[model samples]
Each structure stands twice: as structure tokens, then as C-alpha cells.
Target chain A: MKRNPWRDIRLHGTVLVLVVIAELIGTIKIPITQDVAITIMPLIYTIILGLAFYLIKPIKWIHRKQARIAEGAMMLFIGVLIAKLAVSSGQSIGLIFEMGPALILQELGHLATILVLPIALLLGFKKEAIGMTNSIGREPNVAVVVDKYGFNSPESRGVFAIFIIGTVIGTIFISFLVTFSLSFLPLHPYAFAMASGVGSASMNAAAIGPTLAAFPGLETQIEAFAGFSNLLSFCVGIYIVIFVALPLTEKIYNWLEPKIGRESIMPKKEDEEDA
Target chain B: MPDLIDGSENVSVHGIMNWIFLLAIFSIITVIGNYLGYHHPMESSIVGMAILSLITLAGVWLERYLPFNISSILYISVIGIILAFPGMPTSEFVLHYVSQIELLSIVTVFLAYVGIGMGKSWDEFKALGWRAVVITVLVIAATYYGAAIVAHIVLVLTGVPAA
Candidate 1:
């Protein structure tokens, strides 16, 4: 019942207006390779994947017993070792024959990226360097909200489910719209961040540069945006979702109170049907 | 290598199994991708994962399986690196799939994940926050530009065509 002031500011409102102002004013001269790789190509991938995989949940991934994880990992490792082996072999082979060092090195890099994630994560978190590991996938905001609601209601679950859908769709929708807009002007993620109020001014453009480079000539802008947009989105989006969702959570609490089998929060209303 | 079903204390048997299953589909897709080559890698990977997941889903619905499933997911991620290389002319192979895929969307996914991760690790982020986030974006953005800038400057300063 207490009002949260930040809710009224509308996080994006501040960031978006500044972004448009900046992009409209700034001028940039970009290097061609960076321009293409960072902006055009990456942006193209982002937009395309957004449309295709946006609705498809990323979390529900392949899960199986005795899956080929080790085999797959080993394959990746072997692929890397082969590349290193090829390096030595290809060197003598190339010097003796007339080929290139590119192949072996390329093979190694590819294998490395694929195989490195697990090892990297394991190493990265060797001693709880990252966080209070307990917080990995949990949401503190949601927990607090649940505690405040203090009722077990099926309707609450229903609303929360819808909220999940909303969050996902909203994320996707914003991505789609931003990409569409990106197609037109020489825009970047910085513009999106500033304009959308997602995170920082230039971050979005920077990050987007590589992804959208496929579009040609738009790489610079796209890469810049990636740098800032996501952070802004995270901050603003969370603030917005919490501010909006929690207040209505009471209704959610009431609706779900009856449907759920558990009784914990609110006292049950005892009424005589005969009366 | 840890077993697909089991892992060390740092990892878990349960978690390993889950990731292993993902790796299985990822491996299938990877094989398909290799066969398809750089061009159709994304498409092939997506299709392979989808088919595997769908079959798995059907099994679950039929009561022959369990539902704590990574019940549905698909992605075609690895091909980009293969497609992008110096001296290798932009072959029709590269051109074909590159045109179809949307790289920006993927970046957004990552950015969103980073955002979520930052939120999850608020303490870490708060300490570094704007400075770290900005620096990361700069480095990444500059990577695109830095490579070119360094190359260009090297050539200009040396009065040689770096190319």
C-alpha cells in the first residue's frame, strides 16, 4: 500500500529522450571491418533470431540422462587438440606442400569457443568469485512480492504466469520493433539505450554493431547500442514490472487463495451455505 | 571428462544430466551443421534441435517420458565464426544464410541475459556498475572498430598498405 516514487518517473522515459537527442546530434566515421562485423552482421542475426526464437523458451533446453555431454565436450576438446596437432602437422605439411596455416588455426578457435564454456564457468566460479551463488536464478523482487501478498491463490499463479508471458513478449516485442526501426536509419544500440531508456546511452549501439552488420552500412549504430541497451532495459524493465505488478498482486493473492490446495497466508472465510 | 549423468561436487549429477541432454541435441545439431557447412549451419542446427525436442515432447505426452524436460528449445549459433573469415571470399555459402538470420536479435538475448545476470549479482554490479558496464560495452564495440582502427593506423603510420 505504500507508494514507490521511482515508479512514476518511468525509467525508459528518461533514457529514451536522451538517446534520441544524442544520436541526432553526433557524427561518426567507422572502420569498414568493424562496421560490418560488429554492426551489420550481428544486428541481422539479432532481428532474425528475435522473430524466430523469440516465443520459443530458451530455458527448456535439451535434458537427458547419459546424454553425450562428455562425448560432445570431448569432441570439442579433440577438435581443439586436432587443431593444435594440425598446426604442427599443417606447418610441416604446408612447408612441404603448398597450403595454408589458416585452416588449423581456424579449427582450433572454433573448438575452443564451444568447449570452453563449462571449463570457463567452472574456473570463473572456482571460489564464489561471481556472487552469492544462491541468487543465480532466483528473483528477490518476486520473493518479496510473494511475502507481501500473504495468500495462496490459483488466480495469483495465473496472473504471475501471464506476467511471465508479458515479460517475455515485451522483451521480444521491443527487440522486434527496435530492429525494424534500426533497418531504416543509421542507428545503433546506444541510441536504443538512450532512446528506450534501457540502460546506458551508447551500450546498445556498441553491442548491436556486430549482430546487425548483415544489413550493410548500419553496423556502426547497431554495435554501439548493444553496449548500453540491455543494462538500461534490465534496470527500467525490472523497476516497471515490480511497480506495476506488486500493487495488483493483492487481487492476484485473493484469486489464487481458493484454488491452491495449501493454506498459509490469509485466514479462510467460514460461511454457512444453509444460511 | 565428467559423465554425462554425473559430475564433480562443483557440478551435480542432476545438473549434468540436464546439460548432457542439451549437449546431446547440441551434438546432433553440430554434426548436422558440419555436414551442412557454414551456410546452412544455423538452419540445420535449429531444425535438428526442434526435431529432437519435438520427439522428446511427444514421448512425454504419451506417458513414456517425464515433463521436467527441456521440453522445447532450438538454436543455430556456431556457424557465424565459420562463415566469417579473412581471405576467404564471401562465398555464396556465406551470403545465403547470412542474409536470412538476424544477428541483432541474438545480441539482445545476450544483453538481456547480461542484464538479468547483473540484477542477480547486484552486489558485484553495484560495485562496478556503470564503470564496468561502460568499459565492457566500449571494449566490445571497439573490438569491431579497434581491429579496423589499429589496422588502419598501422598502415598509415608505416606508410604501407596493411592489406
Candidate 2:
């Protein structure tokens, strides 16, 4: 069915209500220690509330079709958020350029994904680990995996699993991660800001909100670094996944799977099942 | 919605119009959030929303019509940079109003939609099982920390003052 935004008034109205309620609650700080605190922003609350509304079965507030529409709308809304972040990036493009090497090199941090392969293999993930560990499994990354391995391939399943996990709790996890890192890590807030740009719009937004709250008065610079780095990830991320991440993942998987690979938890292949 | 990942789906004029309509609604919600959360004035927030919506629309249009294949985000960022670049004629005006709309407010609305949309995927999420969850968390942490650690090292090496 063609999406009719007008018909999805309930979804939009629900979002509006969530936004208002979330904002009203405002930023809350939970002190974990003398110097450490986890800052929960309105964005996190809004997501939790929205999720509650959708997941709670009794209410049946958001139908399946409506949920799908909301998902589509979320994708569209990202464009607007990107615009806002882009403007921030534009305002301080010069400063961003000044920090050029740091900004660009930080992206290599994406390679850290490979660090999880041994753990995944030990955990019994097999071929799936390639898809799951090669990238962060954002939409584009998922598409790349799907494109190469076919949608039903174990690799696609691996990527899809991470993609689903990302879609469901990525923002919350990232927000908390940023706050937690800020609390303990001795890194500069600017470096944290640059790291917040993990190539996913919602995750980037979630990551930056806490960073901005953690460090007052550097909002513009934080936004600029996060936005520009995210933009770089978005533009160049796919190619890296294809040329660098995938091939490297395959190589590592071949080398590591034999050494530490366990019986796969994933369902056996159809051929094996028939055999 | 269009196939944003592959760029195979052509963005129609009809689709753009729908985006504008949705963006207008998003702007109103964000303005309300900005005022209530950050105590920014509604008038300025509204103006900020308008400017952002315009920039987003222009970027979307360019993405659709431009001969080269490029993400709307890149176009939007370029347009935003051009408008807000130092000494640009419109820079001051653009910054003055748009700055009032807190990035968090926009994020709240965006994530709210994401949360609601997630209902359809809940079963899929559950079916992925505990191992996926564990791995996903580790992967996310690995990527974020890896990036932060790298950036921190470079910044220190380059003599950029820490914030």
C-alpha cells in the first residue's frame, strides 16, 4: 500500500505527544559516582515512551501498518535532522578542516569492529560473524552485505541481526556509551564528539546529545565535529565496507574460524538439513 | 518510501511534497520542544524550523535532480556550509534563528518516530537472540571507543588543546 501521511495522523500525533512529554521531563543526571554521571536526555525518554506505546499489547495504539509508516517517516525525518547537523558543520567548517587529520583518522576506528570476531566465533557465530562484525550494520552496510551474499544467506542473516538490534536499541545504547565514556575516559570532549559520528543518524544524534550535556558551552564545536565526521562516514562508509571491511572480515574469519570456531548456533543450511 | 540505500528508486515530485508536509509538522513539534525544554522563544524556533526545512527541501531537490548520484545529506551539508560560512551575507541571519532550535529537540522528535516504528521489528529483534544482542553491544562499543581512542591520540599528537 502506498503510504499516505495524512492517513497516519495517529502515528504523528503519538510522536508529538512523546516529544512534548520527553521535553517536559528534560535532562536528568544519575550520579554513578563522585565524578561520574549518566545523563539521560529528552531524546532517550521520547524513544522509550514511543517504544512502550508500540510494544504494549493492551493499548494496540500503533498498528503494524502504522508502525511501518512511522518507520518510513523516521527515514524521511533523518534528512531534516541531517540538515540541522549540516548547518552546524557549515558554521564551523574551517575549524573542522583545521582538525582534519584527527577527523579523518578517527574513522579508522570503525575497524575496531574486527576485534569482536574471536568472541563471536567462540560464541558460535560462524559465517554470520563476517556480516555482523565487518561493519556496524547500518542500512547501507546491511544493503552491501545483502547485495553480496543474497538476502537469505547466512551473511545476510548476520547483518540483519545486527541491523535489527541497532534499530531497536542503538540510540539508547550509544547515548549511554557516550555518557559512560565521558565519565571515565580521559579523552577530550572534542574527540568524543568526533567519535559520536558513527555513520547512523539516530545514533549520532543520540551520542552527541549526551556529549553536549556533559560539556557545556562547546555545543557548536561538538555538533560540527560530530556532524562532519558522520557525513564523512555516510559518504565513504559503503566503499570501505566493500573494499576494506568485507575482504578483511573474510580473511580474518578464515584464519580465526578454524582456530576457535565452535558448532554454529545458527540454523543448519538446507543442504545439511537434508543430508 | 524510496529505496534510500541503493539509490535505485527515483524520488518523485509527489514524494518531495509529502516530505515538505511532514517536515512542516516535524518543525512545529520541534519548536514546541525547543520552547518547553530549552526555553527558546517560539517565534524564533519557528523561524529556525522554516529555514531548516527550506535547506532540507533544497537538498532533497538537488539529490533528486542532480546528474551525479549523491546522498541528500552531502548536498544538505554543502548548502548549509555555504549559507552559514563565515562572512556570507546570510550567515548571521541564518545562525541567529536556527541556533535557537536545539539539536536535542530535533533529535527527540526523530527518535520518537524511530521508537514507534520499531514495533514492527520487535519480533525480529527478539528472534535474533541473546548472542546477537551481546555481539551487537560489543560491536557498537568497539566502534565508538575505537574511534574516540584514535581521535584522542591524534589530537594529542597534533597538539590540539583538550576541551
Model 2 residue A236 CA deviation in Å: 11
Estimate every model's Cα lDDT from 0 to 1: 0.27, 0.76
Candidate 2 overall lDDT versus native = 0.76
Error of 2 at A225 (Å): 11
Candidate 1 per-residue lDDT over residues B1-163, each given as its tens digit: 2243232222221233444353343334233323322233555445433332333333223332344532111011112222223233532344343333222222222222222212221232233223222222222222223222332343345453211
lDDT of 1 at B8: 21
> Per-residue CA lDDT of candidate 1, range A11-110, in tens?
1122222222322333333333433211222212222232222223452221221111222222221221111111222123323222122211111111
Which regions of candidate 2 are displaced past 4 Å? A1-3, A99-104, A117-275, B1-14, B144-163
Q: Per-residue CA lDDT of candidate 2, range B92-153, in tens?
A: 99999989987768878877876675555555445458999999999999889988999999
Give the C-alpha miss distance for residue B136 in model 2, angstroms: 4.7
